[model samples]
Target: MHKPQGYPDVSAYLIVPDAAAVLDFCAAAFNADRLRVIARDGGGILHAECRIGDSVVMMGEMPDGPDAHLHLYLADAEAAFDRAVAAGAEIVQPMQSQDDGDLRGGVRDTSGTTWWIARQEEA
Candidate 1:
């Protein structure tokens, strides 16, 4: 199957209770760029997409959307974690260097998604 240009081989799809909150949190926390939004007729979002680095994150608003967890690798995990905290995310795990050669941390956003942010610390 042919994928969209610049899209990763695997993408994360989020089912959120509030698409706007998800988009805002992703923007503030992960530095994700909003790509698309299909607004639902009454008031909420039907579908949306955003880009974080090379990955495309798709989402839809539903009353009973399931929660999600994501492990995202970034060039600067520290800054991302700080932004996430500033954006009202609850700290799930503190940032630290792991024995597996990575600096990692975790946070839970307003959308109920736990993001595991990490960076390579060694080769």
Candidate 2:
């Protein structure tokens, strides 16, 4: 039998040291619209999803290892970078428009979580 047709992409999850804490920070810094959260017995997040603009950001408790971070695509990376910095986020990488057609930069939030912001050039 063949698998039924379905949405190609459903969701993604991020493992962090503090899911609830990070969720709050993301909401404040990026205006994330939290969708749902499932908390585990040990206070770790079992599952969670948030919406920043049209894109969805999924996060949960970090596994037994190092932390993880990811990048986000925006219309104006420079503007986003500035706002994040003004909000007390540390600059991990300075803003620069790359030859590959992207304005990119990095910032580490107050919780020590790093985030990359970029703007892809229009084709």
Candidate 3:
């Protein structure tokens, strides 16, 4: 009906070269749960959704796509960053405390999407 449960009003939609790999990376890197995958008749994923934290990220397969940059706030940003690297994501920035009261880092997944992970200090 009106937006799915546990999904934010504004969600990020990503189109990548390999939707399946991105889905798997999201699961491993962010502990996201794969929710749905609608496949094309010929082949490849036409659409997919994953629940990362309280947000639902929609994705589809598009070769050499326009890359996306997503920022995520997590309880343990370091662990998530480690998991992302272990899952084949290239580290673009190291985790470090920021003046804005957040520990942040970044990584680029194989699908060309860059993820900025942070653990925000409680105000």
- Most TM-score-accurate candidate: 3
As a whole number from 0 to 100, the lDDT of residue 96 in candidate 2 is: 83
Give the Cα-based TM-score of candidate 2 against the true structure. Answer: 0.74
lDDT of 1 by residue, 7-119 (tens): 78888898988889989998998889999899999889999999999889999987787879999999989999999999999999999989989899999988788999999
lDDT of 3: 0.93
lDDT of each: 0.91, 0.73, 0.93
Native-to-model Cα distance after best TM-score fit, residue 117 in candidate 2, in Å: 0.6
- Model 2 alpha-carbon drift over 4 Å, by segment: 1-10, 42-44, 63-65, 121-123
Clashing pairs in 2: none
Cα distance off (Å), candidate 2, residue 54: 2.4
lDDT of model 1 at residue 115? 94
Cα-based TM-score, every candidate: 0.91, 0.74, 0.93
Misplaced by over 4 Å in model 1 are 1-3
Report the lDDT tens digits of candidate 3 across residue range 13-122.
99999999999999999999999899989999999999999899999888978979999999999999999999999999999888999999999999999999999877
- Could you tell me the TM-score of candidate 3? 0.93
List residue ranges in candidate 3 displaced over 4 A. Answer: none
Q: Over the stretch 51-123, how does candidate 2's per-residue lDDT look in tens digits?
A: 7766677776765435567688877667778878877788999988779888788998765678898888666
